[model samples]
Target: MSSVLAKVDWKSQGFRYFPLKLHYQRLFATRVQKISLDGGFTCPNVDGTVAIGGCTFCDNRAFSPSRRVRRDAIQAQIERGITGLRRRYKLEKFIAYFQPATNTYGPLDKLKTLWDTALEDPRIVGLVVGTRPDCVPDEVLDLLDEYAQKTYVSLELGIQTIHDASLHWMNRGHDHAVSMEAMQRVTDRGFEVSLHVMLGLPGETSEMMLQTADQVAKWNPAGVKLHNLYAVERTPLADQVRAGEVRLMELAEYIQILADFIERLPEQIVIERISGDAPPKNLVAPEWCLHKGSIIRSLTDELVRRDSYQGKNCRMQGLPREPS
Candidate 1:
């Protein structure tokens, strides 16, 4: 009998199967590592550029598994993170992931010193900047545009959802159109963009998530991450979850939601991550999805079990997905 996932043809489907880009095999081809660096940058929400308080659900401690969050210097943080990373695996090079409070929410003059210091390190192979859509400006994008010419520069935008109501409920400063414009602007700059979206947000449904994914696919980012919302302890969303004001998605429900999300992509956008990797230590609700590897594996099995793959809809329309 013929099977759908039999060969796991990422190219045949017009989009790389979520499994290919979502898996570790491609992330660390030869056992590379992610060195988390804290640029000590503040957020607009806290700095008075946007809302007084940050997102209701935000607790960056929940993301960025990198251990160098508190390190004072960027070079020290990178070196320490790299040395610590060796305890886990043996990799000569690493992707220095700038994953802290708004990485670009600062003056450009300071940005130069911070970035130049990190690049001076010899072990760093690539750079990944994680920031909010509202944080990055045109000049910063131009800086990244120039950097991409020499090194692999990955810009990750934390766009939790496209639904305005959900954005309001989550306290994300930017709206749907802002996110789209930000993505289009950055994508047009030639620097690779890795978008971050979440599922199971307040007042969001399967349809809303599909809509979010549809819009993200249209942006055609190099990577799209769909994660289920995790309400960390002490966050506003956590209080809501405790008081029954908010809801969480079960692992199975989340898996189904993720599968549906992959179906909506334009077939060319790479599905970098399919779920939020909220560490269990800070996580409060839906503890099951905290284990990223297990969630990914389970999601892969479900996709295969359903006899489906990424871009199932695109291939039907005779549209070829662009290479991400």
Candidate 2:
């Protein structure tokens, strides 16, 4: 490794155990929490701008904490989210995260108005917008770029899977090419970018999941959010699971896949999430998915058992550096 990369204080820097959570602190010199704000945005696929019924596995309400929908005002949601998060975490600064739907799907003026409203609170130190690849346009990117100059900003694109079959299966409005193009545009403009991927998607094997990792590494994103596929009630995926057309990966199987996937990724890539949990009331299968704490412990134990760490076998090899 170059002396620059070798000098990273992995242990003290928190990369030895978990790198993603601490990445923001290291950059901003304090704990910066992300407050998920529902901006009442809709996806092209859901609105018939692309397709009709939305993604197969999607039910936006399932992922939302307060079950926030389009009717809720952005400011009220942020205030409520901040109050709860502050009481629990005692955090002072936060990033306004526009999560759930296609955050950048509207016109530049409307998008800016929402972003400005969310950022109006002085406590908010940054902004992170999550949206589909096809939803981002030059104007949206330009708006995000303007924010980049002022505060911490990251554009999280939900790329899900690189395989065409999986993309088609999910009824994602765009193809892999569009995702690549979106990523390139974000990176080329020197913006911090993060991508989301799901493991154990129907028909994807361990090898295929790792292949997605390989492709992601080549793109060199600043962060990644990894999730395990789980069936939720009232979604098309749940129907498929009930019909025995889809099989969710068990807890142990998902742990192994996650550990292996992390090893294959470049060490510098911040793991924004290891796995996702669906509310018990909304979940239909893979009962173990609700055990977040146990899963983390098991994952830590597995890593220790193998005496391995993130980037143990990256596609682009770098000389191992001692953890500080």
State which candidate has the highest TM-score: 2
Q: Candidate 2 — worst ten consecutive residues by lDDT sum?
A: 1-10
lDDT of 2 by residue, 1-324 (tens): 011223335655534444655666566668878888877677887877888778998885433223334423877788888899988897888889988778887778777887888788898888899999998888889888888777778899999988988999999988899988888787755357889999999888889998898888777787889889888888899999999999899888998999998888777777888777588998998888788778788887888889887888788645332221
TM-score, each model?
Answer: 0.86, 0.89
- Per-residue CA lDDT of model 1 for 1-324, tens digit only, reads 001112234665443365433323443345556688777776876555787567888664433323233324776778788878788777787777878788887778766676667767777766789898887899999888777666667899988888999888777777888887787678756567878888888678788888887777666676777788878876888899899988888999998888888877755466777766676787898888667889878877887788777777542333433332
List residue ranges in candidate 1 displaced over 4 A. 1-16, 19-29, 60-72, 315-324
Local distance difference test, each candidate: 0.72, 0.79
Candidate 1 Cα deviation (angstroms), residue 277: 2.6
Candidate 2 deviation (Cα RMSD) = 4.5
- The alpha-carbon deviation from the true structure for residue 261 of candidate 1, after best TM-score superposition, in angstroms, is 0.5
